[model samples]
Target: MTDQPTTESKGQDGPAVVADGLTKVYDGFVAVDHLDLTIERGEVFGIVGPNGAGKTTTILMLLGLTEPTDGSARVLGMDPARDSLRIKSRVGYLPDEVGFYDDLSARANLRYAAELNRVPKAEIDSRMDQLLESVGLSGTADKRVSEFSRGMRQRLGVAEALIKNPEVLILDEPTVNIDPEGVRELLDLVQRLRSESGITVVLASHLLHQVEQVCDRLGIFVSGRMAAVGTVAELAAGIEKGHTFEVEVAARAIDAVTLMELVPGVRSATLDGERIVVTADRDVRPEIVELLADNGLGLLGLSTSTVDLDSIYHTYFTGAVNHDNVNA
Candidate 1:
């Protein structure tokens, strides 16, 4: 790790990625509008939204693949535009579509990547061995990439990104078009990488479940702008006035719904047959339970629900947004 940009020598002291008022415009349309973001070291940060929500454009700016029309971004404490070469050495990137030589065996392709990243000759073999098993590809290492499934290829792409032993990793739409099991495997691998290596990761995707499954924090993008950024609970707290809970009573508590509305923290309550849906600024389950017990009603069940990622997206983009207007 000496003089190399491995996770060890990088010195995790400050934010790994930062963007201040970062804006990108394609002709007359805006792709990213004054975006401000901060990703801490050793955290898996997910950027999520629907397609054409400016996620790719933001990633391009951060990678220095495309210039931002306004503002600036920094990766690993260096300006991406001017220090792109140095930053690229420290940051591993995986695009939505990973390409590999169909004729090359998985092991052979990894060897090429290791060499390209300038891994020490003595370290390359051991590193490859470790990575293959880590990504669940050791059994198929000698097989040609053409024989690998879509999941296998993505796993290989992850191994390729780690060949450099990068301090930071950025994945764009990593789980798109993959089966459910494949998505789960890929996301699990992401969590393992962070826990084992403490590498800072930036993941860009439109899949809500995938992001929530692994990321420590999430940034919700909407029509070239960020609608919210935080943990799922924090974002949910800020999105609507509060949280929601679904409660069920053994008896039909239709009037209980109206009574629940008067609870200290409850905003409103509605009855769905025997189920009661209560919206509140804070948790009022205790008071509700007390009320039921006082009335000799039995509590059957209780559940908490947050403002889902899809609903959060809709809150910002209520109507049709023509992001195609921006060509970036």
Candidate 2:
């Protein structure tokens, strides 16, 4: 492996992307509001939210396509707003809706894009060939882009982003047009990029399941602002730690709650017909089994339920945007 210089050994120079109080306003309407984010090198960071949540707008600013109304942002130590050309050379972007010249062959389309990016003429052909093969488009290299399927086009778009082998990759809804199988392939490629090159990746998507699989850290956006930023486990532990569980016992619902109250770790217990749910600090499986076994209460089934990603998003957003007013 080539010994590439990393941001870590450089200390304060560790962050690959930084946004300090970033904001975008349009005709008195705020799109992105005082957002602060940091993305470290060699990490896959994910941003998630619903439609019109300023996810696309945020990415535009990061790519030097949208102007920030307040504060500032930098990619690879250069201001994207002011040093667009410099930043563009160091970062690769894949938009949510990828478009291409329909009449041109895959090879021809990539050749045109490569020239625009100013890739060396001598290396362009070989690089394009490698990228096409990497994305499973080698067989369709001579085929016109118009004949390609939506999934194929998406794969080509990914190849286009990697043409220059950028150090930082920014993708917006990369899995939108991809099939389930294609989604898996695309995700695997993304993981390979980070592992092989240690490239800092910024992925924006609504697929929380996919995000949870790849991201080392995540930022949840709501109403143009970041509502929460942390790892999956950290967020769960902090917000959902005190959640209550429901318990039910066959024909003796009241007895189940009464028996659960005797357990040392169980904070509270509630009963429903034919089943019981218990909420406790730690995993209640062992205690529940012991309690049922010792009390001679026939335990038919036991399950644990906790807050999921959607639940977490709602909890923060419902409070962040109350009665159509955004809170500071």
What TM-score, over all chains together, does every model reach?
0.76, 0.79
Q: Candidate 1 residues 70-183, lDDT tens each?
A: 999989889989998788888888888888988999999999989988889999999999889989999999999999998889999999988888889999888987888989
Q: lDDT for each of the candidates?
A: 0.83, 0.79
Q: What shift in Å separates residue 313 of candidate 2 from its native position after superposition?
A: 4.7
Error of 2 at 14 (Å): 3.1
* Candidate 1 residue-wise lDDT at 111: 98
